[model samples]
Target: MSALAKQTITEQEFQGFAVTDFPASKRLKVVTLDEATIRAFNDAVSEWTVQGIEYKPFLRFEVADRLDAITNYTLGKFLNATVRDRATGAFLLNYQGSPNVEEGDARTEFEVKLSTAVSHIIGLSNHDAMYGQYYARFTVRNVDDSDSYLRKAHRRMELHNDGTYVNERTDYVLMQKLKEENMQGGDSLMLHLDDWAELDKFYKHPLAKKDIVWGAPKSKNVESKVEHPVFFEEDADGKPLMLYIDQFAEPSNKAEGKYLYEMGESLEADANFLSVPMPVGSMMVMHNHFWLHGRDKFVPHPDLCRELLRQRGHFTE
Candidate 1:
């Protein structure tokens, strides 16, 4: 059995889902919910509309509890443990069958709620300034004019950590795929800090602990900049906690610039990163600090479009 499999209660079989190691990396657990769990969850939450859940903040946790209850609460416990463990701090959640809802707005609403339940299971999602909600839904197309690489489809998004510019401590990031169209080559990319071959080479460097400026573009709705080093803090066991992005860092001098440059170059060149293809209604939640994530560029197609939902926030426990 894998290390992550050892931590889970239901390895071979569970109440509503089954757990397995991702093919690319053992650090990521793949949780596939049975069809019954999907139908039962839909029926349970049918009484509450997406609008109603949004109006009542606490209803989100109620939805989370309802789903967990269907699985005998084992799913929640396993997911919490998986994310908190540095040895395995991520999971890919996808269902086996379709629910009662049809495609379009109804389907999107169902997915939003599904992601919400998953998000609250481990942590509460922060209000997204860009989308003006607890969860943000955005689309990517062949042609793009976005200020950041988030919506661009032609080029690869370099590996980096989230919450670099935000004041809040973003402990987790949840990314879900809502829709896809003519999309050929857009897969989610991930890498653990310990897996990076040059981690120690950069961690011991002087600039690794020096404060660097980080700022987002106007599209992100974050006007203020924050200051922090690449290795901002450490875990209880003294492991490094990182917050960085190649596009957002602002170095004032040559030394700072070179340090940031080499770090980005090393991360991009690392061969240990995992490239995951996210199917519709599938979501991946990861510990934001130790795990670096990005997206592989999509194949050029005029009609290509992919809708995605994102929720990033700190862990509750």
Candidate 2:
């Protein structure tokens, strides 16, 4: 087994109802909500519909507290710690079975509520400008005419960070798979900045801290351009944190353009990226600055359809 695989959890570690790195990446913990914990959480928050939680923001935190209470406050601590720590700043959260809700739209609504609870437990999710909601739900299919790389199939979406064109401090991102049909490929791709072989190369480059302009396409609903260096800042430990993407950066000079272009090329070429197959009902949350994420291309089918829910937000601390 590879060193990474060796770090994954053994079957024995699955005993607890909380955290385990059963997945290949030690940085990505697989947090399982046992059936009891799920039941307790659902029962406690059963009074609120998804809309109710949305209307009253404080209720979201209450729901999060209830869920954590069911797990003896362990889930909240583990999730916060995992995402806050520089060494391991991501996690995959899912319950063992389908949540208690009607099939179809009702279940999807409950999923959204559950995701909201999880997000609030860690921090507040930023208002998703594209969808005009705290969270965004969109679909991908065999055919798409969107302006951005998002919602397209049959092509690999390069790894990138979120909130690049906004002024918000996007400390974390949550992506949940809602539904899928005739889907092939499209596994989520992630790479820790520390794991990238070219991390130091880019961080040490003279242009590393030079400010670059970033603007979103119309579809993103962002009206203004923002400027920040790709190597935006360092963590408490003084390691590099990145904010880069191929599509949005408007490099002005030849040197800046080439630097960004080469950086994109190097990231795509990097061998350390983890391709995680996220099942429906599973949500992947990661530290925004340290972990870059993207999607693999889908094998086109006339009926191919996939729905995804995303929430990007800042950490509480």
lDDT of each: 0.92, 0.87
Candidate 2 on 1-317: residue-level lDDT in tens? 23343344232243327676845788889888887777677778888888888788899889888887776676776777778777788999888865677789878887887899889999999999999889999999999999989988989999999999999899999999999999999999999999999988889999999999999999999999999999999887788888988899999999999999999999999999999998898899999998999999999899999999999998784
Q: Give a tens-digit lDDT track for model 1, residues 229-266.
A: 99999987899999999999999899999999999999
Misplaced by over 4 Å in model 2 are 1-16
lDDT of 1 at 309: 96
Model 1: residues with Cα > 4 Å off, grouped in runs: 1-13
